[model samples]
Target: MELLPVRPTIKTPAQAFTGDVYMTPIHSGTGPSRMTVALVRFTPGARTNWHAHAVGQTLHVTEGVGLVGTRDGAVLRIHAGETVVCPPDEQHWHGAAADTFMSHLAMLEAKPDGGDPTTWLEPVADELYEKANQQ
Candidate 1:
C-alpha cells in the first residue's frame, strides 16, 4: 500500500460547471489501475454540465443536500449518506441544492486508451435549472 501525497483542491473550470465548484483528487491510479477518485465540493446552485462516463460513475454524498438530474427531466434529491450510481454512458449531472452546499466522493474508471473518462456537454439551461431547483 502506498500513501499518496496531498493534493490541493482546485476550482473547476467554468466551461464544465456552473457557479463555484472545487475538487481535491484523492487517488487517480496510474499505470494499469485506471481508477480515479476525488472529493468534490459544490457551492449553492453550483453544478456540472451534462456528461457521461465510459465505465459509469459513483457518487457518495458526504455533506448537505445534492441534486442529480438526467436527460429525461428526472431530478433526484439526495442528502448526506446517499449514494448514486450512474450507468455507463448515461447522460447526467450532479450538484448542490440551490440553498445548500454539498460535498461528495466521485469515483470512476479511466479508459485504457488514455481518452477522457467523462464527455462533457452543454451547460444546463437557467430555466431548466431553476425549475429543478425550486425545492
Candidate 2:
C-alpha cells in the first residue's frame, strides 16, 4: 500500500467557473485505472460553467446547500449528505447556493486515452442562475 501526501488547494480558473471556487485533488488513478477524485469547494454564489463528462460524474455534497442544473431546465437543490449523479455526456452545472458555502466530493473517470474527460461550455446565464436559486 502507498500513502499519498496531501495535495495543495488551488483556486479554480475563471474560464471554467464563476465566483470563487477551490479544489484539492484526492486520487488520480494510474495505469489500468481511470478513476479520479477531488474535493471541491464553492463560495456563496459560486458555480461551474455548463459542462459534460465523457464518462459521467458523481458528486457527494459534504457541507452547506448547493444547486445542480441540467440543460433541460431542471434544477436540483442538494444538501449535505446527498449525492447526485450525472449521466455520461449530459450537460450540467453545479455550485453553491446564493447564500451559503458548499463543498462536495467530485468523482469521475478519465478517458482511456488519457485526454480530458470534461467538455466545458459557456457560463450559466444570470437569468437561468437566478431561476435556479429560486427553485
Candidate 3:
C-alpha cells in the first residue's frame, strides 16, 4: 500500500460544464488497470454538458442533491448515498439542483486502446433544466 501524490483541484471546463464546478483526481490506474476516480463538486445549478463515456461511468453521491438526465427524457433526482450508473455511450448529464450544492465521487473505466473516456456535446439549455426541475 502507498499514498498517491497530492494534486491541485481542477476547474471543470466551460466547454463541458456550466456554473461553478470542481474536480479532484483521486486515482488513475495505469496499464491494464484502466480506471479513474475523481471527487466532483457542483455549485447550485451547476452541471455537465451532454456527454458519454466509452466504458460507462458510475457516480456515488456524497452530499446535497443531484440531478441526472438522459437524452431520451429520463431524469433522476439523486441524494446522498445514492449511486447512479450510466451505461456506455449513453448521452446524459449530471449536476447540482438549482437550490443546492452537490458532491459525488465519479468512477470511470478507460478504454484499453486509449480512446477518450468521455465525449462531450452541447450544454444543457435553460429550458431543459427548467422542465426537469419541474418534475
Clashes of each: 0, 0, 0
Candidate 2: how large is its RMSD? 0.6
- The number of clashing residue pairs in model 1 is 0
Residue 92's lDDT within candidate 2 is 100
Give one digit per residue, the lDDT tens place, for model 1 in 3-78.
Answer: 8898999999999999999999999888979899999999999999999999999999999999999999999999
lDDT of predicted model 2? 0.98
Cα RMSD for predicted model 3: 0.8
TM-score of 1: 0.96
Clashing pairs in model 2? Answer: none
Question: lDDT for model 3, on a 0 to 1 scale?
Answer: 0.94
Name the lDDT value of residue 9 in candidate 2.
Answer: 98
lDDT of 3 by residue, 59-103 (tens): 999999989999999999999999999999999999999999999
Query: Candidate 1, after superposition: displacement of residue 88 in Å?
Result: 0.6
lDDT of 2 at 2: 96
Query: Which segments of model 3 are wrong by more than 4 Å?
Result: none
Best candidate (score: TM-score): 2
Model 2 lDDT per residue over 1-135, tens place: 999999999999999999999999999999888999999999999999999999999999999999999999999999999999999999999999999999999999999889999999999998999999997
